[model samples]
Structures are given as C-alpha cells and as structure tokens.
Target: MAEEVKLFGIWGSPFSRKVEIALKMKGVEYEYIEEELGNMSPLLLKYNPIHKKVPVLVHNGKPIAESVIIIEYIDETWKHNPILPQDPYERAVARFWAKFIDEKCLPALWNSTWSKGKDREAAIEEASQHLNTLENELKDKKFFGGEEIGLVDIVASFVGFWFGALQEVSGLELLTEEKVPKLCKWSYEFVNHSVIKENLPSRDKLVAYLSARFADASK
Candidate 1:
C-alpha cells in the first residue's frame, strides 16, 4: 500500500504554499485540508501541538511542522524529483540562502508592509538591503541553486507571490524591474512555473484580506 499523505494548509499563506509546491514537485499524492486561521482544526492542534501552524505534513500518521522543515522531510522521504541537491556543499549553500531569507528577508518584508512612519521607513531600508544582497547573489545564475529550482527557490517563492500583494496593499514599490532587474526576472520565472502559476492565491481576495488586516492593525 502507498504511504498516506495529508497536508493541512491555509489558502492565502505563502508558508502553506511552500509545502504544497514541494509535494507537487515530488509527485506525492496527498489530501489537502484547508484550515481557518481563526478556528483551527482539532487534527492540526493534535499534529502540531507546539506551533499549531498550517502546512503540516502528515505522512502515515506522523506530523511535520514548519514549512522549511516539512519541505526537507518531503524531500528526504519521497526522494523522487529531489528538491535539494545531492552534493553536500551545494546543499549547504542552498540551505544558507533559504535560512537567510526566512529569518532576515521575510521579517523585513513583513515590517515594510505592516509598519508605519519611521518604523516603516526603517523596514523598507532593511528590506531593500536584503533585496540588494539577493540581486548581487543572483548576478550569475538563473536560480539560487543554479539553473534548476531547488530548496532556496521554494523558500524564496513568496518573493514572487506574496511580496507583490503586500506591496499593493501597503502602497509600496520596493521591487521593480529597473531597481532589481535580476531578482525581478527570477520572480517572474518562478511564478510562471506550472506548479506556482496554478496554485497562487486569488488577487482580489488577498487584497481585501490584507486591507482589512492593515485597517485592523491601525485601530
């Protein structure tokens, strides 16, 4: 019998989409269960008792939390259409970029969207610096892991999807073709990939959701 796989996710969450993309890339068959952020399911709580976040990958009754960790798990378990490189040095480099984006770039990007006044300005500056670093890093390659999409590509996929929506909602334009040409080109290429193109969140819904979120935060 084939191993049973199930994914608990939220529609608009880029973190959730990362796991979904990894699953699709690996040709893993799984059931998708959409969870409401406000009222999470009991199974989700049972699976990820610590974080209780969505994008939990349950394989044969075992639960894996954290999007990157889940992606690594999927890659290690399935091993078919590998997301990470086999070479140790290359894999380490990919993990470094992935971790950097997850820790530094993502927080700066989020602050740029949600913060106001001086805080927002600082956030934009920080985010721009991170983008600049990425631009310099991508000066010689099509993807972070060279010509093919890999772990770093998956972790940074949100730059193509959520970053634009956040920019629209926040009324900021940090990523432009002229500003970060290479990064912008990579984003377009990443988003146009079959898996990403098909699975992106609806623009209208995201706009409304983010608008409400900002409004609520302001109050």
Candidate 2:
C-alpha cells in the first residue's frame, strides 16, 4: 500500500510553498490542508507542539515541521527527481546558499517590509547587501546550484513569488531590471516554472492579506 501523506499549510506562507514546490518537483502525492495561521487548527498544534507552525508534513502518521527540513526529508525519501546535487562539494555549496538565503536574506527582507523608520532603512540596506552578494554569486551560473534547479533554488523560490507581493504591499521595490538584472530574470524563470506558477497564491489576494497583517501589527 502507498504510504499516506498529508500537508498542513497556510496558503500565503512562503515556507509552505517551499515544501509544496519540493513535493511537486519530487512527484510526491499528498493531501493539502489549508490552515488559518491566526487561529491554527488543533491538528496542526497536535502535530507541531513546539512551534505550532504550518507546512507540517504528516507521513504515515509521523509529523515533520519546518519548511526546509520538510523539503530535505522529502528529497531523501522520494529520491526520484533529485533536488540536491550528488557531488559532495556541490552539495555543500548548495546547502550553504540555501542556509544563507533562509537565515540572512529572509530575515532582512522581512524586517524591511514589516518595520518603519530607521529600522526599516537599515533592513533595506542589509537586504540590498544580501541581494548584491547573490547577484555576484549568480554571475556565472544559470541557477544558484548551476545548470538545474536544486536545493538552493527551492530555498530561494520566495524571491520570485512572495517577495514581489511583499514589495507591493510595503511600497518598496527591491528586485528591478536595472538594479539586479540577472536576479530579476532568474525570478521570472523560477516563478514561471509550471509547478510554481500553478501553486502560487494570487498577487492581489496576497497584497490584501499582507496589508491587513501590517495594519493589525501596527495596532
């Protein structure tokens, strides 16, 4: 019998989308359960008691939380269309970029979008530096991991999908044709991939959701 697989996620979460992308890329079949982040379901809480975050993958009654971890688990378990490089050195490089994006880039971007005044400016500068580093890194390669999309690509996929929506909501544009030509092109390619394109949330809806979130946070 095929093992039962299910995913608990919020539609607007980039983290959730990351896992979804990995699952799709690996051709894994699973049930998707959309959850409200504000009022998380009991099942989600039960599955991830520590964080209570979404994008929890339940396979054969075992729960796995955290988006990147879930992606790694999916890749290792399925092993059909590999997301990580096979070469040891190349794998380390891919993991490094993925960690950089997850830790440095994401936090800076979120700070820029969600904060105000000098703090926001500082966040923007930090995020710009990260983008500059990524631009330099991608100067020679087509994708972050080289010729094909790999772990780094999956980790950085939010730059294409959610980043633009956040920029629209926050009234700031980080990735532009003139500012980061290669990144802009890469973003287009990443988001336009059939699986990603089909799975992304509507831009208008995301903007409204983010705007509401900002308003609520301010109050």
Best by lDDT: 1
Instruction: Please give each candidate's TM-score.
Output: 0.96, 0.95
**Candidate 1 accuracy as lDDT:** 0.89
Worst 10 residues of 2 by lDDT: 140-149
What lDDT does the true structure give each of the candidates? 0.89, 0.87
List the candidate 1 regions with Cα displacement exceeding 4 Å.
none
Model 2 lDDT per residue over 143-197, tens place: 7767777888889977767888888877888888888888888888888888878
TM-score of 2: 0.95
Total clashing pairs for each candidate: 0, 0
lDDT of prediction 2: 0.87
Error of 1 at 215 (Å): 3.1
User: In candidate 1, residue 107 scores what lDDT?
Assistant: 94
Tens-digit lDDT string for candidate 1 (137-171)? 88878888688789998899877778988898878
